[model samples]
Target: MTSLPPALLRPLLCTVVLSTPLLANAQEQRPGVQAGITFGATTGAYAHYDDKPLVLPALSWQGKRFFASPGSLGMNLYKADGLRLSAVATPYTLRFKTDDVNDPQLRRLHSRQMSAMVGINADYSADWGAVAASVKREVSGHGGGVESSLHYSYPIQAGRFTWVPRVGVVHSSARLLDYYYGISDEEALRSGLAAYKPGSATSPSLQIAVSTPLGTKWRATGVVANQWFGDAVEDSPMARRSSQTSAFISLMRAF
Candidate 1:
């Protein structure tokens, strides 16, 4: 049997459940709190990892300058025309506990803890598409690394459904990679795997999301995404594949 890491639950729940309200607010621009339940699952990319189930209650709030959503909380510092800037704090979730792995060797490795990340985000929307960029640094002493990303997305409307397709690339600092994917000398001896210290890496990803209104106050949304690992991450003994795929679906009602 595969063990479910407690650390994995919070991040997954926040990412899938709380994010629903943000999506709904973006489309409707309504000002109030939204609440709902979400259910989803993910197939991890790590070696000997099993599918993890996600079920949780979610809450989101958007105000004139402050906003709270799944995985993040921020205050808008600048907004005009089609450009907006914000200072945000979020949880960094690319980590795992040893018991979460099914492989005997991997189970001997030390666990990685989740951390808090503080960052700034800038987004611009135009008639053609939207672009978003962010730079965040781990501040909880878990990794003490920096991460940044750039993304582009375009939304299309088909009758009652809205489709959004996005492409993005994420850059992880060497410290982040090492903390999460690297094998220490002691770990190598215990797990009988070669020691590895990886450098910085860049990963690219693609996603498609669809949403429709279920009623006047309710909305349903779904997302599918695939992210390819960088060479450094793919080389890790704990990694079984070159990419990871995840999906999420949720229904939310605004108050």
Candidate 2:
């Protein structure tokens, strides 16, 4: 399959993941437009990538059975009380900037690029937390990989703040790993690096999120997550580290 250029890939992913609302999750209270700014950072996975910070807009909309948020979207196809099934879209919006990597060979590598996936998600929600499972495949980048994950989260209330802790495991196919990290024969010849292929990989991740009300019409939120990539991704010649970390904090005003 012909893959899209990085320039074309991003907007396509955003449109699919952030522009549409989900069909279900009736309890979601996305009243009015919420807008904010987020400041965050991620540790690079490939060689030579230094930790970099990102500042971007945060926006979301929620209603009856649908919700659209930056980088994530869902439409509940079916909902019965707290147990719901929905069609979901998620863009793995993360990418690497290779300009400053330590390895000249790896620097010759192409941009890690970006992709979006679509699939179905199932969730069971309660006062405690939620159990969720999903499967999606890369649609925009044509990474030719599919992912499946199972996740669980619990929310703990503390005064004016609510904290949620989540843990999940994601499994990706070999094709996906190769597309993102593998060095092709041509790339090896041009970059003077041995060709390497990392097969399918599974990663386990943990995340924590906190939200607090800011007086009347504003809210503050923060989240950080870490994932340990599987050996298939870690062992790649382009990898500088096996683990990746990301952080975000934002304040939003409801319209």
- Where does model 1 exceed 4 Å of error? 1-29
The TM-scores, one per candidate, come to 0.90, 0.83
Residue-wise lDDT of candidate 1 within 1-67, one digit each (tens)?
8754666754464345324423432343457887777667655656876665777776678899998
How large is the C-alpha RMSD of every model relative to the true structure? Answer: 3.7, 6.1
Poorest stretch of ten by lDDT in candidate 1: 17-26
| Candidate 2 error regions (>4 Å) | 1-29, 96-102
TM-score computed on alpha carbons, candidate 1: 0.90
Find the candidate with the highest lDDT and give its number. Answer: 1
What's the distance in Å from true for residue 170, model 2?
1.0
Estimate the overall C-alpha local distance difference test score of candidate 2: 0.71
lDDT of 1: 0.78
